[model samples]
Target: MNEMQKPVIGFTCGDLNGIGLELILKTLGDHRLLEICTPVVFASNKSINFYRKSLPDINFNYASGKDFSRLNPKQVNIYPCWEEEVAITPGQLNETGGKYALISLKEAAQALKAGHIHGLVTAPIHKKNIQSADFNYSGHTPYLKDLFGVNDVVMFMVAENMRIGLVTEHVTVADVSKHITKESIISKLKIMHSSLQKDFGIDKPKIAVLGLNPHAGDEGLIGSEEENIIKPAIKEAKHNMLVFGPYSADAFFARGQYERFDAVLAMYHDQGLIPFKSLAIGEGVNFTAGLNAVRTSPDHGTAFDIAGKGKADHSSFMAATFECIEIIRLRFGYAEMRQNPLRKMSARILANAVDEKIEETE
Candidate 1:
């Protein structure tokens, strides 16, 4: 039997003033999670402790030092990005919170880049506050894309009921049409198709594409994107994948049509997220698909409304953390699956050669 491989997962403190660390602490409090993977959190010790006091129920015995050479496998490990004390004012959105959140994220990302960690599970970061000269993207999807030097990636929302991939995310509603093209649709479809196979372990996945307009453009009366751009793209993808429909978004979800397929590809953000978040009901995970590494985050954002009330639900955060470990395992299994085909092909060739030799001798 093969030995168990517990992946080293890196967790990033998204916003110092938000519930990011609160969720992380609650999830890591359970000793059962430590057996599956070693966690490395990128945040200051002061920042972690500040939240720990409020969450009296949680118990996370951790260690930190100048380096990660001698990490304890059974406890949470903190790699402090800032040595000096940080002023963490919970339930407030300020420049200090954004600055330190960026610091933690960059540190965690660098560790992930250098192969120090196997996967990343990020806490929620406020988009507007986390913007600057160095980080001016709409979300982590684009930032990681540019950082990893990847050409394209998909913002895939995963849940127990359905999985949704967006063609255009964080784009203005008015400009959503300008971004919709046959090529872009096909590209997102390809990424989603591969992710379902490798990341989610779905073989021969059936993907459904949603329309861009109401009533699916009423056959081009309301909008022409569905007929002109989306339909042709689905047809092109059908040559290689099991892709179907520029279905009307409203009626599709209203009648539970998403259950008929493995995944649904939405033209824009709300088209997909509205149904996904409603159905996920606090258990959704936002996975950045098509990157070289694995990353997942809670579908919900920094709930500034309920930041430090001790009322924050950690289910989505826990789901994201557990999903990160699962995807890492699935990816290894997928790599082994790819190698098996070659071995089988080689054996078949050898068998055919032996049969030819026997025939010649007879």
Candidate 2:
């Protein structure tokens, strides 16, 4: 596709009772968004229409799954997953809606692999509700990893100036220590390095590796994981990647140390995400790294409390959508620094010849 041709982004219908449909509908309502990419929602026609009734001011068309081949940027393309009637009540959770959400996700993934879409920007999904429907997957990251057979996948949450990656996700605090290893840390670092330079357009990105214990174990006084596991992993990763860390988690985030690095590698979920969500709030974007296809989603969960109230903010969803576009451009060679539509009128890729030469000697 040419630069003028808008990229196609496939979206999954998140929990029907939640705010997924509302946010997707509200964001795509803006006609200007069509200028960047075609937003396609894989969902049931009835559910979308039901949500539409709640959002009366938004203007967009919905297409059925059987007619997916005829999609255009002129309307919100809907790949219907179900023909049955759905009783979608705002702010309420139902088991019936859970089944349809999974169906839509499966169809979206298949279409993405078939080259029908450039990338996927998913809405928030409730793991507990999906699990109640007999879905065994932990979350989207693990499911996508299994779908593409990608073992090196890592989840990075982007919040303005800070980006955080978890070496082990969706596990208990007790199990987190056992999951940490030199190999796992090294693998995540490599992916983070590649993603910063390739996807995020960072050149020679510096990464901070946070320690698992307090005060970085105080040189083996508080703990030895820093010296025995984290330090060694950082040293070994230097052969192929640039990484420096084993900093205390508490002080690292509190002192705003993350701003100094392109990305920070955290030991577990809450260790990295607590501070990230505090800063990013509604503007955070969750991106899956080390995958052949680019996938991103809102960092927050399905807000069942305010579902259907028309109170959900589209900022995070919009951020994810824009991030997907940049990833597609970089991956397909459409997003060179000079061609980026989001940048200044006469943007130029900075010439870093001096830094390259200096680094060669070091």
Candidate 3:
């Protein structure tokens, strides 16, 4: 693709002390990545040079710019967000690292809103250190929700063919049950359904909803959430799309049931993440669905323990970059298809008839 045709992907330097820059440098170092997208790193030249000096094996060369007007497709571009002198202590957590991380994120978010960049790939951030008077959100999903003026979003994680979404993210286990209401379940299902069709390019997506309790509450023996809230929400959601089961989380993955569905919705964070991480491991990417703009991040965290060791794997970060680009392209195609309402309606009706016939036979 040419310079203008290629998507300009913006990267946020998450916690300077963490492996955020390391992953970015390592992924972009391959040179072949530039052919797919024009990368703009939202950090100062000083930070880039610091990492380059430390890891002399990697090549870090890019054009320095504050905007996307002159993005070089052949070379990575450094968008100067913070130019002040800062200490570089890799693998240590501090307030200064979080401060710079937010600065980079804010700059890139602004550019994203102004239509300068097509998509955003955020590195992991230290949630506690990043919190300040100006930014007080839990993580990137909520932060981007408020930034884009969206009411709800889904924290969808992808690793190859396995796609898992959480109904309640980053909340305590005690609060998770309270948040798993019928409305919330339905809302998340809607987001997941739309994301599958528009972002992942699935025509008719099948989603499995996991229950809040063990054995899916054993059909109300252990907990009433499956019978009361989850089932009701799934019933209502089926009218719009194909949704099935408040399935037992353990057997769902253990028996390879996740392979049968396009996506799976877990009631809480760990329920979805534990299995996904176990299966996908170094290749998972977290995609924030239901946003006007495409935003993705590595599935793992800041990795403060392995920050400076040069041992942090870049596979997940690379997957996030590829996901962002693919989602951007898919969204374009989805928009074009949506422009014709008659065609969409015809397809929907035909699909429903086929589903009805299959149900009758079964």
Candidate 4:
């Protein structure tokens, strides 16, 4: 396919001090990806060359410019988020890194919002240093939620073995209970259902819900939230979806019960992530569900410990990019399928054909 034929994917370099740029360079350095989609790095050429020195084997070639209209289809492109060079101290978590990281993100977000980019794949960003009066979210999901003016979005973790969505993410344990409600649970279930069908192309997805308390509140002896809150939510969601749970988080994974369901919903962050990251290992990708725009990220934070050492793994970042491109394709296909004029007539046409065949056989 030609450059105009492939999807335009934008990458945000998260926390310049971390391994964000490293992963971007390593992942984009491959020549094969150019055939699938045109890759745009939302960082300056200087930053690219900074990390390029370490990985001497990987050929780093790209077109550098702020204009997305003239994007090179055959080679990587840079947005040059900043003109002046910024100090990049590897393994350091400081505002200096956060400053530039946020700039790249904002620029990329603007392009995405304006429809210049089809999808966004963000690297890891530090929650603390990146915080300001304007950006006050815990992470990307919440940040994008506010940017796009969505009421809520799901922090969905995807892997071959399991898919998990958090009811409450980046919330303190003390405040987790306050965040989850019957309505919230039902809302998350809807997002997962739609995402499975549209993003992953799994129709009629089966979802399992995990409880906030141990042993799923142990039949109300341990807690009442499961009985009073989660169960009711599940019951209501069952009206239109195949959802089951309020399962004990421990037994659910230990017994491999999640394998039966297409997706799993946990009451909070660690309840789902601990097992997902451990199981998915290095191949996991984080997908934001229930959003108008497609966004994905590596299922990892800034590896401050291994920053600039050329030791950071790019598998998850690569997976995120691939997932972003795929979702764009899936969403486009789903939209076309929904809007196809023949769709409404096809069901009746099939029924008549079946009836005619039955009559002929008889």
Mind sharing the TM-score for model 2?
0.90
**Structural similarity to truth (TM-score) of each candidate:** 0.92, 0.90, 0.93, 0.93
lDDT of 4 by residue, 84-130 (tens): 97888999999988888899999999888888998999999999999
Candidate 1 displacement at residue 269 in angstroms: 0.9
TM-score, cand. 1: 0.92
Q: Write the per-residue lDDT of candidate 1 for residues 1-362, one digit (tens) a residue.
A: 02386898999999889999999999999989999998999998988889999989898789886375677788999998998977888899999889998999999988887778889999999998999998999988999999899889999999988999999999999999999999999999999999988898776678989989988888889988888999999999989878888888998899888887889999999999999988754489999998989999998888888887778899999999999999999888777767799854654565456432111100
Report lDDT per candidate. 0.88, 0.81, 0.89, 0.87
CA lDDT of 30 in candidate 2? Answer: 87
Whole-model lDDT, model 2: 0.81
Relative to the unseen true structure, what is the C-alpha lDDT of residue 34 in candidate 1, on a scale of 0 to 100?
A: 91
Over 4 Å off, model 2: 65-69, 132-134, 334-362
Which candidate number maximizes lDDT?
3
lDDT at position 274, candidate 3: 94
Model 3 error, position 201 (Å) = 0.7
**Which candidate achieves the best TM-score against the true structure?**
3
lDDT of 3 by residue, 64-135 (tens): 977577778899999999778999899888998999999999999988888899999999999999999979
